[model samples]
Target: MIKSEIKKLPGSQIEISVSVSWDEWEKYIELAAKDYSKEIKIQGFRAGKAPRDMVEKKVGTGALMDAAAQRVVQGTYPKVVTEQKIDAIGKPQAEIVKLAEGNDLEYKVVTSVIPEAKLKPWKKEIAKVNKEYEKKTAEVTKEEVEKEIEEIAKSRVQHVDVEREAQDGDNVILDFEVKKDGVPIENGTSKNHPMILGRGVFIPGFEEQVVGMKAGEIKDFELTFPKDYHAKNLAGIACLFTVTLNKVQERKTPDVSDEFARSLGKFKDLEDMRKNVTEGMEEEKKHELKEKRRGALIDALVENLEVEIPHVLVHEELHKMIGEFEMQLQGMNITFEQYLIQIKKTVDEIEKEWEPQAIKRVKAALALEELAKEQEIEIPAEEVEAEMNKALAQYKQIKDIEKNIDLARLYNYVKGMMQNEKVLEMMENVK
Candidate 1:
């Protein structure tokens, strides 16, 4: 195996150019043939049943040659980098350096990797936060539960439909058409869509338009979409909507009875349902409070951090956030393109919005890494194993993904994240 020094590039790229001798090339061919033999086919044999020589001939010299090259690069590149004590990151760009039988197998793999960073000194500033928070008692009081019950009960509360006009919080069934410049905006008209007043799910000020509309009332209103609206096309544009009330109904969420509790499934009575909901809320509150503390601690650490966060990592994190945002939009039956059209933004525009958050995450990661060093926070192998197992279980729906994933990469990422959690907790308690 021919070895070479890795070349460092901006944004975590480590490039290594290398060549293999004829012996090495032959070895790679054998390796590739073993991995790919089942797929090879040739004349005078069943599919994938040809002899090695026949398959190689049928597949063409070039195909086997390329495969041989890939085998050598894929197997040797990372091993060489590791042996040479060079850190590589992400997926490297592999290029054929040379290709000729009996000459040499040659290639270069450019990998993006996280660089070594200095750990920041743990300071006294973070200790006090933990102390103060520790002093505050966490409670899931009965009063709070009762309050939640009352709020939910209000939704199902019996109400008389007044002859007057419907107001905010009153239910109205209506048909509406939205238009721009006297022409209907695409997908802007609705008939008998069940809309709840005061839900706030509509665009800002949309729910307000329905308030005070009496039965048989026809209302036309023009409003401007907020510039920051999730949809691009309609963002910051004023449009007109024509709404006609088809019916008015008051909500009575079936009084807090046994029947109502059973309707929701799994409750002995109203009190049982309230208790369960309260517990759930209590857990949610605890999580939220913990998150706030963690966020504050991370903020502090990043504020004091010193290091160059790889742009690659920032982009990766940003991409994850974008995927989540897109998923949420998808759940609402909106595509990313549709969202862009509605908000009048391209994917790049969406990316720009998340850039700041990405930077913050990267900074926090660097700070946490430093903090982890200072605190000697070591993630146990068992923890990494457990994390991997969990991830693998989730990969069942993804074909070939379990095998294709680079486990070392996943382990490092998870290990770093776990250490960061410890670092944040330490920072939160730092005085």
Candidate 2:
């Protein structure tokens, strides 16, 4: 049997002082002795074969009793939480107060609970926002559709060799070498490199100097690197480039017509292509509008509500955001440390910077959750099961995820996401 004294503290914290019965402590002590016996050899006995008395004597009874107390605390904490309804937000801080062999083991656990939500009239605010937001009807104009068709035609453009002088928008093949202080700079020479004039691929003044140069024409000019250039060695320095325009190429765009549309694929004619593009554009506009309104609705809802968000929740959100940022960095093949260096911030500094945003996110989430509860929004079990199964199925493809993931927690997360979406939809439809 276990007994506990629970004390409420400021900031939704609770302190639970628990005492375990002698019999229970003894059981864990015996188990601890068995574990200790596995580690060391005793005279006239193989490893782990030592008698309980011998093991207790070998490893001090105090150490064994302390281990037993920890075991009891670990095993009994859930029962305490269930009986007391802790609604704990994070891990508890546990300290053993008494661990003597014959006396009942006692420990105290301090932990934070989920804070209660105190909010304003969210429904009225949402309704007002919904009414104020006027949905714009998106219409695709003929000129816009024709512009899209012209873009498609440009994609199919062909380049043809031309004997004329190089001009802006003309593709030029050239040989060039850059020199600083009359010495050829390494990695500054190329032959037959193709570049479009005025594209700004080369140093400033290099391509403009190529303009009006015919095939086999060569010229020399000086160009200054940008003051804020990425390379410190060349930044704010002047260099000379010897250039030659080997050839000039002219671009020829395909004609926009029914034949061209059919050639692109799957389109019966030009009208069919235009109709498809219009439909796509309309759908894109509608999705953009919906997203805009959704953001506005959430902003309005958050503005109307007020709550004292707990630090634990904010910390959790901050960590989650950091994890997402880390994933993005990983996708870019950059290490988190490298990103920190680029951003010129320490991990602690980054967290401090994100604290305000984290607090806002937590408050908004709690407000939405409270609104959901007040509106009695419930997610169907079948829908939750379906989402869970779908998520688990995705996990099945990734090796070792099954071992790491907790299905119960994932189910709750999916259910919560569904509930939030449902509530948002309800708010969106408000008149």
Task: Provide the TM-score for each candidate, comma-separated.
Answer: 0.62, 0.73
Q: Candidate 2: worst 10 consecutive residues by lDDT? A: 394-403
Once fitted onto the true fold, the runs of candidate 2 whose alpha carbons sit more than 4 angstroms away are 139-260, 269-271, 325-350, 390-405
| Cα lDDT, all candidates | 0.75, 0.84
Cα RMSD to the true fold for all candidates: 7.4, 5.4
**lDDT value for model 2:** 0.84
Instruction: Give the per-residue lDDT of model 2 (tens digit) for 1-431.
Output: 79999998877788999988887667887777787888978889887777788987988877777777778888998899999877887889999998776788899999888877766766787777777667467777889988988998998888889988888998888999989999998788999999988879876777788898999998998999987664568889999889988888988898989999999897999999999999988898888888888877888888877555667888899999999999998999998888876566798999999999888888778778888888899999999999877777775464577668886888889998999899889889887
Cα misplacement distance, residue 122 of candidate 1 (Å): 3.5
Residue 216 of candidate 1: its Cα lDDT? Answer: 84
Q: Supply the TM-score for candidate 1.
A: 0.62
Q: Which predicted model would earn the best TM-score?
A: 2
Across residues 1-431, which tens digit of lDDT does each residue of candidate 1 receive? Answer: 57566677766567787877787667777666554667754456665455557657667778888888888887777678777877555556789978998887778777777766664554654665566567665468888887776677676566545566767666777899999989998889899766778879788888788888887899998889888776668889999989998767676655667777776667888878987988888888888888877776667566667666666787888888888988999899998888776667787887888899988977777677666667678989999889877878876665577568887898888887777767676566556
Give the clashing pairs for model 2. none
Q: Which stretches of candidate 1 lie over 4 Å from their true place?
A: 26-71, 82-87, 98-101, 104-106, 125-159, 164-169, 175-191, 195-244, 249-289, 330-335, 382-418, 429-431
